[model samples]
Target: MMKNIQLKAMGKINLGLDVVRRRPDGYHEVRMVMQTVSLYDKVGITVEDQPGIRITANLSFLPLNENNIVYKAAKLLMDEFSIDQGVSISLEKHIPVAGGMAGGSTDGAAVLYGMNRLFSLGMGQKRLMELGLKLGADVPYCIMRGTALAEGIGEVLTPMPPMPDCWILIARPPFGVSTRFVYENLHLEKIDRHPDIDGIVRAIEDSDLEAMCARLENVLETVTIRKHPQIEEIKNFMRERGAVNALMSGSGPTVFGIFENERECRSAAEAVRERGMARQVYAVKPFNP
Candidate 1:
C-alpha cells in the first residue's frame, strides 16, 4: 500500500503586532507575538503511482496546481532530493482565506512536515523551516508549531512558554483583508504608541492574564480598523459580550475574543453569532505546538 498521512494545519492569531520599519526589500520589519489555535485545516497526503503532483480541496476557489503553497512545498522537497514519487494533497480548509490567519502558510508548513514523515525524507526541522521561509514569512512559525514571539519579517521566532488554559472566540466578517495592501498603506509616523513587547513577554512567563490583556496591542489594528469599521464593531461587541481581551488578529477582518474559560468563550461566540455581526465564529483553544 502507498504511504498516506494526514496532518492538521492550525491557524495563527497575533496577540500583539508592531510594525517597526520598512526594509529595503519592501517587507515591513515587525515584532509580533503569534499563537497557534485549535482551528485548523485538515490536509490528507497520499503517494501516487503517477509522476506528478495532484492537489484537491473542497474550496474550489483555492489554486490546486503549482501555485498552491502545498504544491510548492512538495515541489521544493522533490527538487531537493530528486525524488521520483508523486503525491496527492487534499485540503479541508476551515480557516478563513486571506483573513490574516495564515491559512495558506499553515497548509504549506503541514505539507513540508507531512511529506518529510511520509516520504522519510530525513529533513530536519531546521531545514524544513529554512525551506518554509522561502514559501512565506508565517510558514516558519507554523512549522515551529507553538506560541512564539516573531520578529524581522516574522521569520525570527522565540518559542513562548505555554499559555494559561483559556478559550478563544474568533469571528471573521465576509470579506478578506490584503496583508500587502495593509502594510503598504500603513503610516509609520502616525504610529506614536508602541506595544510593550518586553512587558507582554514577562506577563506570559508569569501567566498573568490581566497583564497580557492590558498589553494586547496591534499597530496594524489602526490601519485595518480604519478601513473596515466592521472589525472595530466586532471587537467592541466581543468586549461587551465578556471577552477579557479582544483584538484583530494579523492584518485582519477577523477579530478574536479571549476568555478566561470555555463557558465564557462559548457563550460569547453564540452571542456574536446570534447578533449576526460576523459571517463565522469559532470557539477554540490555543494550540500548543
Candidate 2:
C-alpha cells in the first residue's frame, strides 16, 4: 500500500523587515518578523515501489523539473535519509508566484515535512529546520510556521506568541518584483528611518492590535517602492478602503493590509481588484502553526 500524505504550504507576510548590513557572503544581515497567513498551497505526496521522484503542479508557470524547489527538497531528503521508495508530489498553488510571500520556499519546506512523515523518517523538527536552511533562508521559518522573529539573513527564528487573531488582506500588483534586484539596489546608508523591530515584537507578545498597526514597517520598501511607486499607491488604496494599517511585505510588489473585520477585508480586496491596482487580493488570517 502506498503511503499518502496531504499538507498545506502556508504563505507568510513580513510585518516588519530591516536590512542590517551587507554580508561578505553576498547575503545581507536582516532583522524581521514574519507571520504565516491562511493563504496556502495544497501539496499531496504518495510513495510508491519505484526509486525515483516525480513532481507535478497545476500552475503552468511552475516548473516540475529539478529547477523546482519542491523537487530539490525531495532529492535532498531521499539522499540524506537513503530512502529507496519513489514519491509522487502534486502541488495546487494558491499563493502567488514570486510575489515575495515565500511561496516556493514554503512548498519546498512542505515536501521535506510531508516526506518525513510519510516515510516514517522520524526526523526531529530541529533536524528538519537545519536541513531547510540549505534550501533557502525563508525555508527555515516556513518549516517553523506561526509567527517568528527572524535575524541573521532570515535563518535564525525565534517563535513568537500568537498575534491577536485578525484579518490580513494581501494585494499583489500585476508585475513581479525580483528580490535580488531590490537587494542590489537597496542603500541602507541612504535609508533615514528603519522599522521598530522591538516594538513590533512587543505588540505581538502583548497582542496589542493598535500598537501593531502603528508599528508595521519594512525598510526594503524604500528601495522597492522607488522602483515601482505603484506599491505605495497600493498601500494607500488599501488603507483608504478601511485597513487600519497597510505595508509592503518583504522585498515587495505585494503589499498587505490589516483589517479588523472580514467584511471590510473583502471589500478592500474587491476595490483593489476593481480599481486595477492589484491583479490578486486575498483576505486572510494569521495561521497559528
Candidate 3:
C-alpha cells in the first residue's frame, strides 16, 4: 500500500463570475466560468502508524493547526473513514495567497485527493467533490480542475471544455484582499452590470478565444476595485501592453490578462515587476487536468 503521496495543487482563475443572489443561508449564489491554470503549490503527505495530523508550510503566517483548511480536510477524511493513521502534510506555496485565486482551497482539495488514494478509499471524483464542499465553496471546483461552470455557492459544478490555448499573465500586488471583506461590502442591488456567464460558456465550447475574452467579467470587481484602485491600474497596464483582455479573477486583488502571443505575455510580466505594479507575476498557460 502507498503511504506517501506528492501532488501539485493547481491554482485557478475566474474567466467570468456573476453574483446571482444571496441565499437564505447567507451564502451568495454565483455563476462563474472557472479554469485551472499552470500555477500550482507543491503538497506532500505521509501516513504513519501514530494517530495525529501535522501540517507545515513555506509561509510562516499560515496556520499549522485546525484553523487551516488543509488540516480540516485531513480531519474530515480521517473521521469519515475512521482512519487512525498519523498524517503529515508539507506545502510549498507558489500560488499567491488571498489573491482571489483558489490557493488554499486547492491545497485542501489536494489533501483530500491524496489521502483518498493513499488509503485506497473507494470514493470517486463525485464523492470526493461532495466532501470537498464541506471544506470550502471553492474546494469542489479545485478537485474538479480543468475548466468548469460553478454555481450554487460553488458546490454545483459542470465540467466544461478545456479553455482555448493562450498565455495567462497572473499579477498580484503587494497587498492581499480578504474574500470575506469583499463579499460583505458587496450590495447586489447596487451592481450596475452582471457578467454574461452564458456568453462565456458558449465561447469556451466553441473554442473562441476572442469572444471569450470579450465577455470576461467579474461582478465582484465592482466591490473590489472601489476599495483598491490598484486592481484597475493593473488591468489598464496589461490592456495597454497588447493583452486581449484583463480582469480580476475571483473576488479581488489578482488580475490576469489573456494574450495570444507568448512574447507579449512575458514582456508584460517583466514590465509589471519592473514598474513595481506587482511584485508577484507569472506568465502561465491554461492547465487542464
Can you tell me which runs of candidate 2 are displaced by over 4 Å? none
The local lDDT score (0 to 100) that residue 180 gets in candidate 3 is 90
Best by lDDT: 3
Candidate order, lDDT descending: 3, 2, 1
Q: Which stretches of candidate 3 lie over 4 Å from their true place?
A: none
Q: Which digits, one per residue and each the tens of the lDDT, describe model 2 over residues 1-289? A: 3399899999999999999999888999999999999999999999989989898889887888899999999999999989888889999998888998999999999999999888888888999999999999999999999999999989999999988878989989999899999999998889888899999999989999989889999998888898899999999988889998999988888899999999999998988888988887899999986
Residue lDDT tens for model 1, 9-107: 999998899989998888899999898999999999998878789999999899989889999999998898887989999999999888889999999
Instruction: Give the alpha carbon lDDT tens digit for every residue of 3-71 in model 3.
Output: 799999999999999989998888999999999999999999999889999998999999999999899
* lDDT: the better of candidates 1 and 3: 3
Model 2 worst lDDT run, 10 consecutive residues:
1-10
User: What TM value does model 1 have?
Assistant: 0.98
Q: Clash number for every model?
A: 1, 0, 0
TM per prediction: 0.98, 0.98, 0.98
Residue pairs with colliding backbones in model 2 are none
All candidates: CA RMSD (Å): 1.1, 1.1, 0.8
Better of 1 and 3 by TM-score: 3
Deviation (Å) of 20 in candidate 2: 0.4
